[model samples]
Target: MAVSGARPRVSWSCDPFASRGRLVHEDDAPPRSAFRRDCDRVIHSTAFRRLRHKTQVFSFNEGDHYRTRLTHTLEVAQVARSIARALGLDEDLAEALALSHDLGHPPFAHSGERALNECMKEQGGFDHNAQSLRVLTRIERRYARFDGLNLSWETLEGIAKHNGPLTDRDGNGVGRYAAGLPHAIQAYNEQQDLELWSHASAEAQVAAIADDIAYDVHDLDDGMRARMFTVDDLADLPLVGNALLEVRTLYPGLDVPRTVGEVLRRVITRFIEDVVTETSRRVAEADVASAQDVRGLGHPLVGFSPEVQKAERAMKDFLFPQMYRHARVERIMEDAQQVVRDLFGHFIAQPGDLPPSWQEGRDALNEERLARRVADYIAGMTDRYALDQHARFFDTTPDLR
Candidate 1:
């Protein structure tokens, strides 16, 4: 029943062997694939571990039960691998991208990123995606032969373009970077072209969507757990509401905790299924032939269906005012941002205050270069470490509660 010369399906997944080699070449260590090595290296990185104390939504002082950056990352990895496996793409590559996605997030998540971006506004701004690339390529020095982990080109490319192309085919900045590219990404692209004009691999796309999924599902869960919202509060919001109705129908008298667990379980599962079905449909529709075909398509092949995307939007619309922008959360985030701002100011005024290692050769740099050096050092701090440093530097620091 099949037409002659027609491909059965679009097979645009990355094959580990076909990867562009690392920035610094090294001999094959064989038993593990390049992507598997990338995952291991990410796990071993100090920046990855620092995520334990970093903010996701709630600060450490707020509550121990809320998700930390590290936990959110693990959830993203799990979702990414599920989506990748379902799509018959490279699961390890997806997982590695998911694990490294947040490595560049400042101590207080988006708030911290905003503060840093403000501090470095003249230095082309601080984009976390760009910082993530820097964390992998420049910071986290554990290699004997190189400054970074020397991950495969595929891994690095995924980290750089997980969200999408940074520029147009002509190398002009696109989207948020319409005026110019971030300094860190631009500097690295000079060393090794991340093909900033094209979409990243299918695996990276998987990681990117997985991040959205994790943020939506988990933030709602955290909101409910914090009592900012209740399970009944989500009883009318499309996908989540449908799940809530199903839970109540199946277990009429279930406790609030049990009902919440069931609803979230269904919500997350539906989101993953929607991704698999929609992405597979797009790939088939596009009739792509190779990984490069996938990348050069100008648009990603990974996402939710229109209906599900609408539902996801509804979820966010609900969360924005009810949870993320809640008075308590705003107050805490404001304090966290001030911590970042204060830390930047303190180090800039007293460059000698920086650790001996960070201060090295900083004397020779011009103003812009010195500011960047200071930014890098502060950007790498864990939330608790940042607070501790703030305490050490000033007479009074914000409570961050």
Candidate 2:
């Protein structure tokens, strides 16, 4: 568990033994801490398996080298674990948070999410963060004792509020959800309070930042794989530009792929090091002594230095136009969105199209209930499965190529 430059466990690190326990109490399964158990549950879940075929930025039908959601999650977990270890936080908690972070993302990346959100606009606008909680607390029905995986309270808290507080001090929705809380989160909060107004544990914050690192690095890799841009294209970029120069200078005349890999490796190192240093400085200066103190700090402790923060933003800016919004990607995503919308419309109109298991119960369910159900089913589909379903229901489905 020891990482280079990492310290022994710190006082503010989340203690797996001191976890708040699961929502539905069960006897301790010996030889594993609660957070470790939560991590295992996520790995064993059907949703986790589905991630292999789900889109990250590229659809499953895209070239094999492109990142899939499962690959992305693995990279995030690796980053989170390293950061957590370096910061003397709970690596298990961090890994659990990272592994479970994207379970709620629909197929076709954000395209499917947008389609589902638009379809569920009246019921409860789909927020993947909230949907993550729903997936953990309700969707995965593996255990007879519980409908969901019944993760530990700490894991649940991180997944619910990992990005930051969902609400302000007054408890109104804040951050990305300023308009109103997602219905899934709101309903779950009534049953088990996630302390929506406070920052999550330092471990949780590590996982969130790890997600950013993964996206910034892997998206660049995928973008290059797709010929959306090249490593040379990042020469003017801030943090990455320096990395590219250093790599080229050190390994003169390296091939494009090796140069890309080396530059990305340096970027990840610089980002992780900056976060560890900045967060350590904050932890000491702020006199944070416990995980509870971390939650109440009102801001994240795990983040890059201001300079690196700007660099991260600059990296995002570069990708937004050069990769994400490339006409090729946009055209594909637009068609992917159509597939999702078509599926939603069909399921809502012909409830019989839903699988027997999905339609087995709830004859008394209302419009909102049925709509949400249809969304859940659609949201769970892999990109290939969705296209398949569309082909099954409609005469002509999007090629999504």
Q: List the residue pairs that clash in candidate 2.
A: none
Residue 101 C-alpha lDDT in model 1:
94
lDDT values for all models: 0.89, 0.90
Local accuracy of candidate 1 as per-residue lDDT tens digits, 1-401: 11112222236888887779899887777898888889999999999999999999999888898999999999999999888877778888999999999999989989999999999998888988988989998887887899978888889999988889989989999999898999888998999988999999999999999999999999998999899989899988999889999888999999998899999988889998888888878978999878999999888889999999999999999999998899999998998899899999888888999999898797798889888888888888898999999999887788877
Q: Which candidate leads the pack in TM-score?
A: 2
Off by over 4 Å in 1: 1-10
For candidate 1, what is the lDDT? 0.89
Worst 10 residues of 1 by lDDT: 1-10
Q: Total backbone clashes of model 1?
A: 0
Q: How many backbone clashes does candidate 2 have?
A: 0
Residue 271, candidate 2: alpha-carbon lDDT: 89
TM-score (C-alpha, index-matched) for candidate 2: 0.98
